[model samples]
Structures are given as C-alpha cells and as structure tokens.
Target: MNHVLENPVYSALRTGDSHLAFGTERIKYFNEEVSPYVGFAHDDANGFADLYELLPEGRRVLYAKPIPAVIPQGWQLQHEIKGLQFVYEGSKNIEGDFSNIVSLADEHVDEMIELVKLTKPGPFGKRTIDFGYYHGIFDKGKLVAMTGQRLHAENYTELSAVCTHPDHLGKGYASALMQHQLQIILNHGQHPFLHVRDDNDRAIAVYERLGFKVSRPMNFYFMKRL
Candidate 1:
C-alpha cells in the first residue's frame, strides 16, 4: 500500500481539505480559482478518461505522483516538473520573531496574486488563500515575502507558495516566514512536508536545515483535456 502522502491531493481532498474539493468519489479536484491540482483515488485508465470528460476542453490540471504516468489519448501534455518530497524530521518546535508577520485574508488576495505572479512560486490562484494560515511580511506596506499551507493528508500538511520578492532577497525573509509556518503546523500536531524542484539546491539546503528530509522523488504533470 502506498503512503497517504504519496498521493496527497486525493488524500487531502478526501480528508482535511474535503470542504474545498469537487468531482466524483474516484477523482477529485480543487476549484480552479483555488488550485489546479486534481487527483485520483487510484491510478487507472478509466480514471483518466473520467477526468477528460469531467473537465471541459482545454482545461489544464496538475497531477503529481511518485513517478511519471503515461498520458493517455485525449489529453495534451504541457509540462513535466521533476521534484523531491520532504518531510519534517525535527521534533523541536521552531520559534521565530513574527512581529512583522501578518496573517493573510481575503482582502489580501490581490497582493498575494501579484506576488505569486512576480515570484512564480508555483500555480497560486485567487482563492489559494482559502487554504488558510497564509502569512506574509510587508515593507512600507508592500507585500514582500510569504508562505502558506496547501495539501493536508491526515497528519501531514504541505508547506507551499514560499517566496520572497526580488527586491528583498538577502534579508532572510524566506527563512523567517518558513519558520513561522513551521511553528504553526508543528503546534497543530501535524507533520509538515513540502515539494521543491530537485535542482533547487539553495532551497533544499534551507529545508534540510529546517529539519526536513528528502522522503521521495516526485513528479508533477500539467495536462489539458482535449
């Protein structure tokens, strides 16, 4: 049997994040405004076919797995991202100076979307803040660095959208923001995990220092219904 984290999107949609899920029992997806992720209860050709029919033409969706899958007919492959999954290994609770950290809310969506657009920290959407626990740092009232929670499978929660504006690169904002998020997830009695591009050595090193270990190799497939 595969670990729940192996297919986190499905596990999350069925569990902790169920309230935000859409689609059938066998296949689940987040609202397009929240996330582009879609997951299947189990990998099957019929599942893919169902997804192809469920979504309209040219609708793009992201699927992740421990390994790549063969794209069946009626779907167009757009991009394939090779990444690594990291699970938190430390037991100590992280303490950070969060005086400047502010909890993000619905009113912050426009700035959040703009920051995501500039930083390209993955497929963040207008409703992505709905995942809750999004926090950010502002400089002169301008949003600069931020991070948030994404997939939640059982006791495992994913740390996502970690990014710092280009102008604020060397101020240790990313680390501070990440530590803030880590503290929150840890305090909630959930294990925090994350996925990062395999080649991001700097980020991998930072995550390792923060007590996250590489759990497995992962891949993200972006495809569109035809």
Candidate 2:
C-alpha cells in the first residue's frame, strides 16, 4: 500500500476533503476552478482509467507521480514536471507577528488571482480560494502577498500558493504569510508539506529557513485527452 502522503491530492479528496473532490470512487480531482490536481485511488491501471473517464477532452491535470508507461485510452501526455516535496519537520512554527495577516474570503479572489498572475507562484484560478484558511497582507489597500492550503491527506495538509507581488518582495511578506499558514496546519495537529520546482532555489532556501526539509523528489504530469 502506498503512503497517504505520497499521493496527497487524491488521498485528500477521498478522505479529509471529500466535499471538494470529484470523480469516481477510484479516482478524484479538484474542479478546474479550485485546482488542476488529479489523484488516483491506487497508482495502478485501474486508477488511470478512472481519471480518463472523469476529465473532459483537452483538460489538463497534475498527477502526483511521474508519467506512467501505460497511457490510458483517450488521454495524451502534455508534459511532465520534476518537482521536489518539502516537509516541515518542526513541531511548531517560530513566533512571528502574523498580526497584519487577514483572513481572505470570496471578495478577495480577484486580488488573489491578480497577485498570482504577477508572481507566477503556480497554477491558480478564480475559485481556488474555496480551499480555505488563506491569509494575506494588504498594504495601501492592495493585496500584495498571500499563502493558503491545498492538498489535504489525513495527517498532512499542503501549504500552497505562497507568493508575493514583485514590488512586495524583500519586505518579509512571503515569510510572514508562510508562518501564518504553517502555524494553522500545526495547530490542527497536522504537518504541512509543499512542492516546488527543482529550479526554484530562492523559494527553497526560504522554506529551509522556516524548518522545512526536502523529503523526496516527486513528479507532476499534465495530461490532455487525445
């Protein structure tokens, strides 16, 4: 049996986040509005079949593992991303004044999307904020930096979308936001983990300073239907 954290997205939807999950009993995916992640109940042929049936033609999804040799019917591989998984080993977040951080809500989605567009943190969409527990810092009434939850397995939750608008970098916004989310995840008795591209050394260093250590290399495959 695979460890639950190995396939956090699918395990999340199937277990802790069923309300946000879609697809068959054997596979699960977030609605395109919330996330592009798709997870297989089991990393086997049957799991691939379930994804093929769930996604529409040309729809792309993030698979937790590397591309499998067996391409299921009606699906074509778009590309594969080699990613690194970082897990926070610290039992508690370092003390920081998350005082300026505000709980983000639906009204803030537009600003959140705009921030993501400018920062290129990762895939983000209009409804992604529905995943909840997002916090952001506003300066001059503008939303400049933010971080929030994503993949959720039983014992872990993913800290995702950590980004600061270009003009806001070096101001400690990213660090503050990260600390905020980390504390939230820890408070719930769950460890927070995250994924980053191998080439993103700057962000990786920041995470390391915050007590996250590299756990393993993971793969992200984007697929579309043939």
Candidate 3:
C-alpha cells in the first residue's frame, strides 16, 4: 500500500479532513467556498468522472500528484505547474514571538480574503480559514502578511497560503508568519511540508533557509470546464 505521505491531499480528504469533503467517499473534493482542490481514492477512470460531475461547470480547480497522461473527460487541462515539495528537516526548536500574530477567525474572514486577493496565494476562499490555524500580522490594524495550514494527512500537514501584501515586502513579515505556523504544526507533533512553484526561487530560498529540503518534484494540474 502506498503511504499517505505520497498523496497527502487525497489522503487528507479521505481521512483527517473528511468533514470538509464533498462527493462520494471514493472521490471527494473540498467545497467551492473553501478550496478548488480535489482528491480521489485512486486513478480509476470512474473516480475522475465523478469529480467532473461534482464540480461546477466552469470553475477551475487544482490537483497535484503523479497523475497519468490519460486525461479525464469533461475536464480540460488549463496548465501544468511545475513545483517542488519541501519537508522541514531541521529541529522543531525554531522560535519566534507570536504576540501580534492573531488567530484569523470569522470576523477576520473579509480581511483575509482581501489580503489573499492582493497577494495571490493559491486557492483561498472564505472558509479556507477553517482548515487549520492561520496566523496573521497586522500593521496599524491592517492585515499585511499571513501563513497557515492547508492539507492534513495523519501526522503530516501541508503549509500553504503563505503570502504578504506587496507593500509589506522586504520586511520579513511572511517569514515571521511562516515560523509561527511551522512551530505550531511542530508543537502538535505533525511534520510540516509545503509546495512552491519551481520558478519561485526567492520563496524556495526562504524555505530552504528555514530548513525545508526538497522532497520531490510536483506537477499541479489546473483544470477547468471543457
């Protein structure tokens, strides 16, 4: 049997995050309001078909895994994004002050969405904040930078939505938020991992500097209506 680590998103949908999933157990997805990511139990053709039916007619969605060349019907490939999955390999002793890093809640949802829109950090929705602990930095009462958890599989959690407002760049706000989230995941005894586009050399460097090693190459399939 393949380990859950190899297919964290799919595993997460079927396991730790089933409550957030839609569709049948064999092929589930996160609700449109939460994320545009989906998962299947396997590479079975019918399972893919089930997803095509589950998603709205024109909404684009994302899938990252070792998918075969044969494409499923009703879903056209938008593009293939090359990325690298990084796993933190250093000690969990990394420290940072969480004083101003507030827990993003319902009241902060609108602010979070606005920040995500400005920063363009993957597929964040109104409810993406529900996945796991999301920490943010506020400057003069404005949300400027944030990072948080996305996928969960057994003892592993995928760190995602790491972004900072363009105005806040060079201030290391993103780094601070990331360390805060990473430490939280570590404190809970779960391993921290993240995916970054291959072209994001700067972010990759930041992750590497923080002790995350490239564990594998990844292809993120962005799909849409045929």
List the candidates' TM-scores in order.
Answer: 0.96, 0.92, 0.92
Count of residue pairs whose backbone atoms collide, per candidate: 0, 0, 0
Q: Residue by residue across 1-226, what tens digits does model 3's lDDT show?
A: 2267567788899877888988886887887788878877555658677777776788787777754345578889988778888888877897877788888888988998998888776778889988979888999999988888989887888899898989889988878888888888999999988998889988998999888998877778888856
Q: After superposition on all CA atoms, how large is the RMSD of candidate 3?
A: 2.0
* Structural RMSD, model 1: 1.4
- Give stretches of model 1 more than 4 Å off: none
In TM-score terms, candidate 1 sits at: 0.96
TM-score of 2: 0.92
In model 1, the Cα lDDT at residue 203 comes to 84
Q: Arrange candidates by TM-score, highest first: which order?
A: 1, 2, 3
Best by TM-score: 1
lDDT of 2 by residue, 64-174 (tens): 763334456677777777788898987484678978999999999999999999888888988898888999999999999999998878888899999998887899998
- Among residues 3 or more apart in sequence or in different chains, the pairs in candidate 1 whose N, CA or C atoms overlap within 3 Å are none
Show model 3 residue runs off by greater than 4 Å: 67-70
Q: Which residue segments of model 2 deviate by more than 4 Å?
A: 66-73, 91-93
Residue 37's lDDT in candidate 1: 95
Worst 10 residues of 2 by lDDT: 64-73
